[model samples]
Target: MDLQAIRTFCRAVEAGNLTAAAKALHITKSVASRRCQSLEDGLGVKLLARNTKGVTPTDEGALFYERGIRILDDVEDAAQAVKHTSDNLVGTLRFTAPRSFADLKLGPPLMAFAQQHPGLKLEMNLTDERVDIIGGGFDLGLRIAPELSDTSLIARKICDIRHHVVASPAYLEAHGTPKTPEDLKDHNCVFYSNVEAAKQWRFGTGNNARAVRVTGQVTSNSGLMQLAAAVEGVAIATLPDFFLEDAVRDGKVIKLFEDVPRAPSYLYALYPERRLLPLKVRLFIDFMADWFAVPENHCEV
Candidate 1:
């Protein structure tokens, strides 16, 4: 099979149309179509189903694309190994991360990594909205949770993160404090509406774990928004400790249920499963793991 043909076909599949694939590869639509046709002819199988909507891989094409992607990654890794040092790595890495974490904690480390690999092109989308990694063609996804509900993606735990239940003094004074998970239902609570069970607030871990259904005047996808509402005495909120550290220290919010023990959360680097991971992706994962392992960096959050 022609390497260029395989490359073009893979790009077409990812881009969902010949015009998009062609534009991405800096080639004309005719050229991209021809390359894909040549690839199909050489393989003796119809790789793509084309229509007005877009092109999608056939069953056989899906199998071939999966293996083809792995093969291409391996070949690229070999070329990079011969031509460049680890620091001299080059390529575009597109990723999506939660805006709450990215705004507060992700900038320094990401910038440092980019500086260390100046040849690399970084494309990041920071939003609390959940994104489809495969559909979006993202190289990776960064997430924070006690455990990932999505089993489709492979996840590597970069570091541990803590979640705290917090409320302003006035709110607690007015509504009284929640001593147990069950007390949460009686009070107005800020909800992070992005996750699977937005209103279900979890506490503890292992056999003692439980979730409480909560309601409030405020509902937001952003953790920062939830934190702000809690600080302004709107309602109680369960947010990552990174967002609460400053507010708690300043007496704007009081950390509650310290002795109750909530489920542990971790910073995870998530990516799609593949036969062989790309070198750039692997390097970034390792870099993140190492960077967060430091006491200063981890504690800063």
Candidate 2:
């Protein structure tokens, strides 16, 4: 029943000789022998047999030893778990984000952060649905173009997502390319559905920085889908640079009305109010900034 008694008994069984076990346990020979005897008496079982050479375990002693090792292992794990709880940087960080942002901007930085802080755990839920940070027990959310009206939550702007109008070379060849924003009305356009009245894309041009309401034929809820349509020469699509940069570079999609790029949407880290964020979360946000803010990472990689 007592851990100390079990430990002493285990040592005696391992040593085989009472004198050796006594020295190993930092106790006298008589005390060591008495410990084994008391354990057997307490259990009403023969735990050890004394021969001329030394002592060996009975079947009952062998069973207890086997189970005892497992118990000790569990005890060690419990202690480690407690220690981990006390550490601020430890424990699982639950977060949510839009699917596209999670895949493109978040995954690489998060993976790097995980490697840097091996003890920390991260639970990422990728969804476009607006999640209640406090109610859902989330530590943070990577919100793109969010309106920070909630007084209870705080947001840190990490990066800006610039939008661009793109069309495939084939589509531009088939349909006379739009030389300016006014010419967009005649072309087939792809739109992201969540964006209300997406058929009407607003862009700023010239010193006045105006907004042009363009029309689109194909509409999709997913940014990737809009990008795919543009890539496949289906239609001209206006999308965030993050979504179209590769296609533009590879010549799959060509830019139109280069003078009038859409407004840049900010990417923010939203979290519940706290005096000081945990080091893990703080480090993660900083890593996200570093990974994204670098010029080399802009549209190339």
Candidate 2, superposed: residue stretches over 4 Å from native? 1-88, 146-152, 205-207, 299-301
Residues 1-301 of candidate 1: C-alpha lDDT, one tens digit per residue: 6888887888788777888777666788899899999999988999999999889999999999998888787887788788667778887988999888898888999999999999999999888888767556688999887788768789999999888888999998998988887888899998887877888878888888888888888888888889889998989988887897789889999888888766788999999776678778999999999998988888333
Model 1, residue 272: distance off in Å is 2.8
What lDDT would each prediction earn against the true structure? 0.85, 0.73
lDDT of 2 by residue, 185-240 (tens): 77788877765556666676357565566666677778899888988889988877
Worst 10 residues of 1 by lDDT: 130-139
Q: Cα lDDT for residue 69, model 2?
A: 52
**What TM-score does each of the candidates earn?**
0.86, 0.65
The lowest-lDDT stretch of 10 consecutive residues in candidate 2 is 80-89
